[model samples]
Target: MELQFLGSGDAFGSGGRFNTCFYVRDARGAFLIDCGASSMIAIRKFGIDPNTIRAVLITHLHGDHFGGLPFFILDAQLVSRRTAPLIIAGPPGLRDRLTTAMETFFPGSTRVERRFVSEIRELEPRCTHDVEGIAVTPFVVKHPCGAPPFALRLTVDGKTLCYSGDTEWVDGLRDAATGADLFIAETYFFDKQVRFHLDYATLARHLPELGVKRVVLTHMNPGMLARVAETGCEAAEDGMVLTV
Candidate 1:
């Protein structure tokens, strides 16, 4: 499996990074891990076909993580003229959040059942679900949201990818990343102790316990990528690609 960093910046697009979005693909179809607000622009910048994305696995309802869906659907219909069905999966409130997002941004745009359509699946925490051919398990994390936050562990083609979706340091993180090929953890702050965001120092302290073979720091802010350390752990760029 190949993981592409579609956008690696945080909510503010620090260091000129777009946002926290990624594309995972292989011989099978491609899937988007997160649809951050700047994902479409970054996808176009990388010269990748956005229509190639077959599904989206959202972690939460935050704008930085899921605000790009409405525009992406519109772009696919209007600019790309895509006709394939799209699948979106997330926490319990995913359908409602996407519906509201569509209404707020593109009013009356959800009536595209005649054209392309989306199958939004709301997952129960700690429950495993099947998406297309990928087996995904959602784990709760520490994030202040109306609904519980989650991280995703995806296994496809015998490859595993763990995503720490905008979480603070939580015990479930070790379980989420256990025995994964690559752990994509968010590091939003530099070294300070923050409530909802992860920092480098805290991650370093917990790294040895997680037993993650390879880690890629993502969802970074300007301070992160700008002063990113060369400590064997890679920090994701706008177009960085990793094969697992």
Candidate 2:
């Protein structure tokens, strides 16, 4: 399996981090873990063909994690002019969220027609579902956003990849990522304890317990990026790719 960090920046895009988005692909095809704001541009910057993406898995409804859906859809429809169907899977209320987002951004963007069909699938927390050819399971994460946050465990080609999509210190983290090939965890703070996000020290203490073969710290702020030189784990950067 191949994992590509399309955009690894936090909300502010500190240190030139684009946002929280990743491209995971195998011999079959490619899918996205999160489609945050500016993710489309980041994908294009990587010289990737957006039309080749078959599915996108969203962790929550936050703009940083899912705000780019309308644009991604529109871009594929108008710009790429793709003919393959696109499937989007996310937490509950995904359809409503996208509808509201479209209405808020130009009033009729979601209603636009395209060369390919766009299907939105809403996932229940902690429940496993199949999207296109990818198997996705979401677990709850502690975040201020009323919408329940999630961490995804993706199984593709018999390989598992876990993504800690914007979460606090949740108990299920270790289990969600346990025994996986790669764990893309988010460490926003270096040592300072904060709500709805993990600090570096806390993550360091928990990393060994997860039992994943590789750990990639992502969704980091400027401070976290600065501390990467000292941290032992790999600090995610835009356009970094890791194969397992």
Candidate 3:
């Protein structure tokens, strides 16, 4: 299995990083963890074919995390002429939220017919859902996004990958990342405690307890970006790829 950081920045694109998007490819197929608003551009720039993505697993309803679906669907319909099924799995009310976002942006885009089938699956928190042979479990996290935010644990090709999607220091993270091959976490700051966001210092304090094989920090703001090297943890960079 291979993991690629397509966009590793915070919501504001701090340090010139793109929004939060990660591409995961296994023997079965390729899928995305979060399709941020800047994902389409980042995908194209990185020479990745959008059609190769079989599914998209969303963590929350925030624009930076879930806003690119509309554009991706439109592009697949109009430009790529894609006809394969695309699975978009997320928290409850995903279908409704995407429809609302589509209409708000394109004003009747949801009404347009498309060549491909867009499958929307509302994931039950703490329950494992299978997406095209990949197993994904969403664990509720502490974030106020008008809905329950999730930290995902994905199992594919005999490997596990965990993502701490935008949240403060939460005990649930230990369970989410336990025995995983990679733990992609959000370290928005170096040491300063912020509301609804994780800081590097707190994460470092609990690193041994998490017990993951590897930990890479993402969703960094300017402050975190500046001190990434000092944190002594691998920091994700846009376009960086890792194999496990």
How accurate locally, in lDDT, is each candidate?
0.86, 0.85, 0.91
Q: Arrange candidates by TM-score, highest first: which order?
A: 3, 2, 1
| Residue 20 CA displacement from its true place in model 1, Å | 1.0
Which candidate has the top score in lDDT?
A: 3
lDDT of 1 by residue, 1-244 (tens): 9988988888887888887889988667899998988888888898888778888999888988999998888888888888888899998888888889899988898876536776899888777798888899999998976777899998998988899998889878878888888899998876868898888889988888887779998877766666688445788888899999
User: Relative to the unseen true structure, what is the C-alpha lDDT of residue 4 in candidate 3, on a scale of 0 to 100?
Assistant: 94
Model 2 regions more than 4 Å off: none
Give the worst 10-residue stretch by lDDT in candidate 1. Answer: 223-232
Candidate 2 residues 1-244, lDDT tens each? Answer: 7888898988888887787889988777998988998898998899989988999999988888898887898888778989999999988888898888878985877667678888898888777798987878888888766577888988888889898888777887776898889888888989989888988899888877788998888988878788887888888878988987
Which residues of candidate 3, in runs, are more than 4 Å off? none
Error of 2 at 44 (Å): 1.3
Error of 1 at 88 (Å): 0.4
Top-TM-score structure, candidate number: 3
